[model samples]
Target: MTPLGPLLLLGFISGHLTLTRSAKILTVVLVGGSHYLLFDEISHILHESGHNVSMLVQLGNPRIKGVNYTGRNNSYRVISWSANEEYISSFNSWFLEQQKSFFEGSESLSTFLKFMGHLALQCELILGDTSLMDSLTAEQFDIVLIDAFNPCSFLVAEKLRARFLAVHVSNFWSWYLAGLPSPISYVPAARSMLSDRMGFWERLKNSAMFLGSWLTERMLYSQFDHTIRKCFPPGSQPVLSELYLKAELSIYNTDFTLDFPRPLLPNVVYVGGLLSKPARPLPQDLEDIILTAGDEGFIVVTFGSMLASVNLPVVLEQINAAFSQLPQLVIWRHLHTHWPSGVLPAQNVKLVDWLPQNDLLGHPKTRLLVTHGGLNSLMEAVYHGVPVIGIPLFGDQFDNMVRAEAKGFGLTVQVNQLQALGNAMATVIEDKRYKASALTLSHIHRSHPFPPRQRLVQWVDHIVQHGGRHLRPFGLDQPWYQQYLLDIILFSLAIVSLAVYIVTHLLKFAVGYLCSGGKLKVA
Candidate 1:
């Protein structure tokens, strides 16, 4: 009871903010592939506000060859960290090999371990180098913007003595693992393919998956903590959970308009399209092709960076077949070097190694997007009012596509069900409701009082100016068993058991006394 009193008081008052002036920001983006877009935009925003901004990033990772920065602002200086190219290539190979296993639910425990180990090693490479760590520590950043996916970055924040910490998460479900309320009754796990509205059986499955996912996250955190501890002096480093719980705010690449309505903490901000910009005019070749398609607009297809390694000939044939049946011109962003010899592309179809995804989605002639349901692509689609045919391959993609379908903005078909893709495409194209719903959501997405970038900057500045010490939930201080009131449950059970035992014994004594009295009367 005494412990709870302080917790309640602290939590009640923690929501209050102590506003201060702006701050010098340091952005740490460890996932340096396509994910760099998130940080680049953030750094640009901070830089625009006359704040001193510096970045620590891995230059080894690139989503598209020859194009490293989508909108790299020259104002912010970058500290590049390089890794062995061969090693990075091998790591990507391992990731590619596991995609099928991940989708099939057959991914081995070793695969998961190796992946985390790889991230840990990447951290080691940076933190292990004395000169780099020293340089970073000397920066004395006011605030550190870190990717939530890379828990190891917390050690850097600690070393730099950063005043405040904010996290950017590419996938939203991971936030649930950070001690937020995500009821299994309705909230779907990141990998879950189920919609928010579920039947009894589906609810049961969601609960089971929730428990499993939580356990897996705990294990991963343990690994990260163990690795991070080694980098710091003994007894000084905090565990991964502490770092997450201490975060003042989190910027999720998700919005309520595209997602099912659910409870969220005030500290959790949705700046889903912070990286999005006004669409640029299409490249001349693409413009020419798009213009030639008279009344029937064009379709854009892309599967994102990780899945770009797909070289399945049968899948290519299926895609080609579907495209041939449609009258609309198609711009397929295929990644493999050689086109499959088995199928001839339709006259209306064009293949490219890469495409400006956001720009294409924004084009007026583009009516539909065939995507893998990655969050970035979905956000872009929603921003542009473009409907989607999501063929989720793995990970949070399945969940993202499901939400899209539930929201009436898109439809989803299994990647293997290539035959049905054409029908799914036809249904979405012929149905005006999909486009109308997408446009509605786009309006909602854009209707925030403050633009996403401004909102992000303001929140970050708030945390920096005010220590944000109060934002920590009181539940974090309580023990997990106590937080769930398991102790109270046990105490109540004991009380009930004692009452039943006393009542039964008293009845037995009364019965025994009656028997004795009867015996005495008979005598």
Candidate 2:
């Protein structure tokens, strides 16, 4: 092929050929931690493309946002993920196994009070500090596209009454943002049944996740309602439920190419792979190290931002015991200084504070990765054709790992059990099936034309240009229990019981009166 052919292909992928103008859209992006990164990154691209974007960074510290929207320079900003202030250790409690936290704690009265307090703090911090409320009312945004975690967006959305679009970082949170709560954060279940191919137990596992999430979120929202009621006089809560329910449309940060049987809603859009930015140059030493590994391939181990350097004592020892003997080079990320005793670092065992992940994964010497099963890491592996050995800690990690395992992409390690971790990783390293599966998914993940950013930018433009209100779910107009209908059935049954009782009493009275002067006696 001529050089012109390569240039044309590059043009197509880079979106230099078919780029469109972005709308001047003001959006309240509610990022719930790193989960919001993909949407933020892509939407930023849209901002650069030609639209105006205001990012509400509800979760993460400011990283250099990926790119500007197509025609417009990106104007990225942060918003609080929730309408509540979360201090250190406050957010950590979500990883609590029993599913109990301030949001789901035993102190009903206290939890209620704190959530209310948190809401005020949230309003003051998220709205007041961020100047979100003013921006909403003054800037008069056409739409509000929020991350799954950003409850603050609901209030601003109500104030602005803009059209709302929900951007789900993944399926698990999508369930909650979709008004169907979930306990597992990593596993994004579909809205429909094609996902049932994972079988009954898997589905049951998903249901359990929903149960946990439902119970917890219900508590917080209820508390949030009480707090909102307190903050404003009667009739001024600004449609708090709307943010949770009124997403005109949803952008899923998942590639359908990888997650098959992806159940979609009419309002939901699949805009995955929006965060793929081509990597920078790799260091010479790193390239040489990778080349040295050869056919045996190398392993990249990273635990995402949330649970870095947890108190898990056994993890280090087990990793050392396993990696020391292996021919492949091992790259591990341990943020803390503490290392397990008696473990000498072997030539193949490499420790890093951090490594250029995308670069290494794309390298010829790379083969496998050992991660905590973060969606970000999972996407990275699939995109780079590197299999994983997952050590799932909590949230959606377990579910994500399970899906990867099902897809033959990698093995999973139990967080606490070192034996399980070692065994699971062995399978990943020894098995070529894992590598093959990962490569297939990589091809699928990248097959989409125009990076995810282009799609997101277009949608943002559409919402802004059309007025975002039209992008909402008709379902949100219904009340909570009414949407589920459990209360309606119960209420109907109660009415039937009352009618039955009245008829029975009247009939008995008539029968007695006909028989004996209409007088009735108590038993």
Candidate number with greatest TM-score? 1
Q: Mind giving the per-residue lDDT tens digits that candidate 2 earns over 1-523? A: 9979999899887774233444435555543335554655655675667656666554433222222212223255443454334462463343332212211213243444454455445544554444546655676655666655545556656556566776666644445565542323334443222233546676676667556655666566665564456444576665455456567667776665556453455556777655454556777777676677778878887666433434344446666777776778887765435444455666787766557767777776776888877777777788888888886654556667767777888876664455565566667767888888888888877876766766776666665555445545555667767777979899999999999999999998789878876566667
Cα lDDT over the full model 2: 0.60
- Name the regions of candidate 2 deviating beyond 4 angstroms: 1-22, 26-33, 58-120, 128-132, 159-161, 179-195, 198-213, 230-233, 238-241, 260-262, 277-280, 309-313, 336-346, 449-451, 468-523
Ten-residue stretch with the least lDDT total in model 2: 97-106
Tens digit per residue, CA lDDT, model 1, 1-523: 6989989887767643334344667888877544676777778888887678887887665544323224574778788887888988887777666764543435555677677777888887777788988887776777888877776677667666665465655556786535677877778876667878889999988888888887888876666665676677887877777777777777777788777777777667777787566799878987887888888999999877555556666777887889889989999986546566666777889887778888998888888999988888898898889999998765577888888998898999886677899999989999999999999988988887887888777877777776565676788668888989999999999999999999999998788779787453433
TM-score of each: 0.88, 0.71
RMSD of each: 7.2, 8.8
**Each prediction's Cα lDDT score?**
0.77, 0.60
lDDT minimum window of 10 residues, candidate 1: 62-71
- What is the Cα-based lDDT of residue 429 in candidate 2? 69
